[model samples]
Target: RVAHMVVEVPRWTNAKMEISLTEPLNPIKQDVKKGALRFVSNVFPHHGYIWNYGALPQTWEDPRHVDPDTGARGDNDPIDVIEIGERVAARGDVIKVKILGTLALIDEGETDWKLLAID
Candidate 1:
């Protein structure tokens, strides 16, 4: 059996763009790190324009470059904002993004799929 129990994140989000697991009143918030988007490869396209594994526009719209964080102004993709939202909704545990970060696709072998693919 799986060591940790499984839970599911909701689809809706608050104005903060973060999803709280405790309840609608206590939505847990986290940033959309490069680790979460790493799954863009095995990603199940949400909203529109399926962002290829490494195709998410760097800095939101740098085009040729890949920047998860907009270290600069006007350097973030509106799409990434939504993708992070979906990730939050799909997740089911501790109300954190890293929950999915350490998840496994098969829970076999020496390491997990997330570790193999993202790590």
Candidate 2:
């Protein structure tokens, strides 16, 4: 199946940008931690984001819903996607992607799904 993916963080950049879930119109903004701007750390040999990371629109992982497979509650955010296409997508770019596979990532005891797709 095909679905829309919002490119929040482009590949090779580390600013922790995300779509505002509580703001007006849900604009894309950088995340803040301890009243300061946040950036993701590179895991040694890798630098910045390994792929174009984003989220599936209108698809939220409800915290109240428990995933039977993972036996954990949702992360209360939209489902994240890893676009592995050749081109680097800009922030806020809504592109059509073909659903390839999905990974159940248990983050902080929450079921954070990572959908793998291609443009």
Candidate 3:
């Protein structure tokens, strides 16, 4: 039960990246081992994303958890987030944000949620 699961999310100490809207869908993820940035891919294009995008720390959508509404598993990754504000965050910038809400998206039989936040 995802709704009943208790996960500690670091609101002030977690690292987040502000993905550019104009840039391709290539996600620039942090290389924790080497302490560097890594370009994953330019797979999808989203024209509706109008804010700084990132993810929450210590929060994972367990792939085994199935949703009752759609009967979909998790995406096996941290919850995606988008920061809405007046400033533009640079790529790979590690910053803090406040979670506002979430949008559940069913992609390929997986429950991929996008968290809404503010800087």
Which order, best to worst by lDDT?
2, 3, 1
Tens digits of per-residue lDDT for model 3, 1-119: 02111122222223433323334663543334366644334334623234666666556788889977668989787777767655566555556666678788998779989876676
Better of 2 and 3 by TM-score: 2
Task: Show where candidate 2 strays beyond 4 Å.
Answer: 43-46
lDDT of each: 0.26, 0.93, 0.57
Whole-model lDDT, candidate 2?
Answer: 0.93
TM-score of 3: 0.56
Error of 2 at 114 (Å): 0.5
TM-score, every prediction = 0.17, 0.92, 0.56
lDDT of 2 by residue, 1-119 (tens): 99999999998889989999998899999989889999989977878888899999899998999999999999999999999988788999999999899999999899999999998
> Over all chains combined, what TM-score does candidate 1 have?
0.17
Error of 1 at 46 (Å): 7.3
| lDDT tens readout by residue for model 1, 14-37 | 112233334655443443555452
Kindly report which residue pairs in candidate 2 clash with one another.
Answer: none
Query: Which stretches in model 3 have alpha-carbon errors above 4 Å?
Result: 1-49
